[model samples]
Target: MFQRSISYTALLVGLFDASAAVADLTADRVWAQTIDMIEEAGGSITALATRDGDNLNISNVRFTFDIPDTDETVIVSMDGWSLLEKGGKVHVEQPDYQEIVVKVAGQDDVTARLGYSVRGDMGVYSEVEDTLIQTWDIARAEVKLIELIAPDYDPAEATVEFVLSMNDAISNMMYMGNGHQQSVQSLGEMAFDMTIVTPAEDIDLSASARMRGLMNEGFQTVNFKGTPDEILAELTAGGGLRANSALDGMEFKMEGNVEGEVFNVSFAADKASSNVNIDNGNASVSADINDIAFNAFVPAEIPLPLSGGIEKIAYDIDIPLAAAPEVQQVHIGMEYLGLGISDTIWAMFDPTGQLDRAPIDLIVDLSAGVRLDRDLIDPNIEELMEQDPTQFGSIESLGLNELLVSALGAVAIGSGDFTFDMNDLQTFDGIPRPEGEASIVVSGLNSVFDQLIEAGLLQPDQLMPIRMGLGMGFVATGEDELTSEVEVRSNGGVYVNGQRMR
Candidate 1:
């Protein structure tokens, strides 16, 4: 199900890419520029022609690209394509099919086909904003490939299909000032169903993605006062480009049969979203997979009686675009909530049922706050990609916040706030000099060990080293609980529980 949803995203991106490549052309002039635009994007048409009246026909339109240093060429083709100017709207459809073929050297070609169509409002321009807005509606975007043949794989018994329906999803695009700036936004819902048939199994998947709110303001409006490069320069100077996309109430599911056995999977999230904003010579990104319930089922023989899932998973990060000489702070956070397995699985691990299995859960709450010079990460991305790393950056301060975990009848929590000096590396033997301390507290530690001993998983003699290590590294803070205070001095000396280890 997730795979299908990802594919849907890719398809939408492809549609946008194709539309943006030719957005500057007016509806009245699209007929003459259609072929030219395709070629400009490195695609070729086997043949092109215009029908009498108000329609255009294109035959065997294809785009071919050769893999670098490889004997493979990927060809994407459309058959019996037509574009019509009707009632002030441009209607484009390829009723026959769209095909993709990969021809590999010394191998048979692989191919797939889909039924596709598109419709858009033409010459939608707004004088108030001095922007040319084009709106496209995808009423039918279906691909039902019965079988795709591959050289090393058998296609006689395999088939795949994709059925997508969008009733009111209107994609709005705006181009300003001779294509100097452009923006796009879309609303409405897309319904999709996909099927995959293989020799061993047949899988069916479905999903629905709907827009949650009105389109963003700046995403649909672009400034045209400057040239293309000039506009880009201005945006970069101010804060680089920014783009945001959001979806709410998204749902997906999948069911399949493997060798006559049945299985199912599904997930739902209150909201799934991503945002990228580049400003102040920095780029900040945040993504949320909120309130997610992932469940799976197998044949009764599998011995799983309940649905297991992740309640939520999310992450956020901030990064600098250019190097800064001063200490720049960056933040990162990741969290896992409500992670658990079935009680039946737990019972297997604790047959005696005296190990507090019900409380046997897993959670990771962690975040990083660090300060460092931008020069460490500052490098032209293009140039950095072409070589290997040499020198590394220095950290001024680090903060480990919200380090919490609860599992196996035990809970541990800790946080670290520390600072470092990069100039003095000898004290730490080539590492930065450090000055600060962090504390960790673990409850139910002794009780957990007692349970292990009671369960015969550990012997009394086995705890000798464990006890010695704990006595040396941690101090008893309470009954069945231990505490550790780790401190690093400016001289690079390290201590735990007030006892110097190094």
Candidate 2:
């Protein structure tokens, strides 16, 4: 996840002891240095403008960049800037930053207007050599979701084109707040390389699609349309995650398979990989994407799980498709529902995240003869039948029909593969048609339940309905312990369905 934040504290640190220690920090100077660095790195940083008074008004710092190796030329523009002191507090007023913008020489580009304000004072007393550190942590927050609509494209011929909305989208960001460990920081001068063409060579929708299958709702919209070949994009992207920060300027290949939409094509990372170094060595995933799949890999792995709500919960296992039943391209889905990172702002920062939050939708594709021993889940149903035929009449005597619906709300997606499909319907019963087995891989249930109990969020007595509700069948397979499974068949017990959102 890319993070973004603004810094007023660090910029003002020297000003705090001001009067004599701090000198005039000119916006133009900072702008000049920033631009010079961008150019020296073989980039085009132009349109530099600056002004000084009570407010250092530096506006219109627009530049187009073509990074080394890749072909995507990511456009970087800072249209407005103002540094002012009000009531003794230095503020970056008129700091209307565009978060992201999808750029094309003469096409549609999404410019995301951003709201930025920081509380602190910033002053550059002397021309310090290392004034700008290797990286800077801007800020961090608990909630930030990027919503996008794909660009329009030609339907006839498949072409690859994309507008990353790099204009308004905030990159190279660093943020901080209540739930972080280290101060947020973003690295700098990163570039990616890639090629863009019509009729994208290939893409692996299996993973993304499988995740999407669970949700009947279409997945998030990310459309790209342009015939940008060997696109050269050089821009900085960073943000805060409690204390963690990153800055990367990359150049990657891109192509618009569809006229207005950047569809299935190929991409790759190049050149700059040599100079890239993450401050937090703990970063787990990094890679190159090219023709064969939606995402290409360099040599990055998933981050290791940490502790607390920050624990990174994952079941990274592959499935043995050969052992599984014969099936054509399997439209895979998730097992969990309403999955999300924990409400804690520090969750993503914890080395071992506590199944922080669950994903809304997850997708996958499977070929025949492929038995997946995946660190995934199985879409399933849990049925509870009456032990005796007469029990129904007795139970109904209690006027418990209302309780029936309540039982339906018990089972839910616990995370991972289970969350992919289980998020819908809240509760479920064997509709006339069953979606087959509830294949899933689960962990942390006991811990999560324990946490609930400790927080007085749940009661032991309440466990029965939940267990019975989620149990594939009420029949006990073990003497004392209740068991779970990946299959569901029509049995004597009732099946529950969709649960209403609270």
Candidate 3:
């Protein structure tokens, strides 16, 4: 973000010159032309707003492409009545699928406000057409910069580019038979680096997304290093069975021997429909996060001759993540059909490499069924069904809310074998998410407790709430030596307790 004040006060000295009439501008023409200009400059725009006097007021302008693209455009808010250049300030109306206003502080020094929206398709499509036709949208979303950085001496001009590091929270739904299918097998995030053009620009910027229909998971290559024991201890810490859930919105910060290279986010979708690979020095990790679909029928409202309102729905995603180190292949799969949707995902890496910046070499060999929200394209689908389930009498309604509750209920424990290619692992925080594949042997109910103790993450006396809250308990008599083995490999050597686990 470039922060400063531009006092067009000197316009009278020159700018306000012979061009007395700055191309008679209107909001519409200004918007259209803004797109033209940004595209001309290798960028695109998303929202538009105006800084009234000393304040910035945004409009209700939300735009998305037919399919996702590297949309980099600038937003110019021309008065509906005049072309008077509006003060520059960027605001985000939707960051985390939720509604919140992003405040932009700009004085007379600002030129034009810019906005960006990026989306790209990278699914395991049978053909290019399949991937192209798919449609995806964000439901509930949120994001925060929390912190940022600027170059030295405060440059002359700067523009910070913020990208929504892809699949941070994407849940996909696939078409199966007459109904839709859904899945939970997921992927990770990649942060983007912000570009600074000058010192006269504002430094505040934002990015966010909310995936509602599918599990946005793909493979990628990454390079990173961290203390072995510290990481392993954190890994086996007491976050409990719902580690993913607990780490849900947490982002990692890593320091490396490398410079700005780890700062930019690069997410690969199909990458030509191939597999992903990453090699680490001591522990590099490389694997493919394929979308596997489970077969199921999603509820859909059959439009009637004189029907009105929305429909009701319920679905599921069953996945088995397993693999071997030598091959380091993560076999992720699901069964989905017909109503299968056309979807998308986009990524923009961060300027500072403190966050996600892993090289991606993903393969879209995944075959899974997605359970879609009938309301995606049609809004009335859910309304009609909820107002009156009878409207869906002819449609197969599997009492949705019940199904999920029961399915979630059936999971006695969130225990699973976790494998990380020591070679590919970039960093180790409290611990790493259970990745790769291994035979999971759930024994002592002490999993949540033992994990924390083994990795020396938490004390048994610490709030066990994180564990018991998830409806889990120790299956062992006491904290006896619990054992589980993980067979994995990586270009970089593996580390456990700061020691090698392979």
Best-fitting candidate, measured by TM-score?
1
Q: Cα lDDT of all candidates, in order?
A: 0.58, 0.30, 0.28
Model 3, poorest ten-residue lDDT window? 400-409
**Residue 95, model 1, lDDT:** 53
lDDT-based ranking: 1, 2, 3
Error of 3 at 453 (Å): 2.9
TM-score for all models, in order of appearance: 0.73, 0.26, 0.21
Candidate 2 or 1, higher lDDT = 1
Displacement of residue 348 (Cα, Å) in model 3 is: 27
Tell me the tens digit of each residue's lDDT in model 1 across 163-251. Answer: 66554344545444444333544545556677666765443433333324323213312233445555444444663556776665566
Off by over 4 Å in 1: 1-25, 28-59, 65-71, 80-106, 117-131, 152-167, 178-236, 249-270, 296-306, 357-393, 453-461
Looking at model 1, which ten-residue stretch has the lowest summed lDDT?
1-10
lDDT of 3 at 250: 25
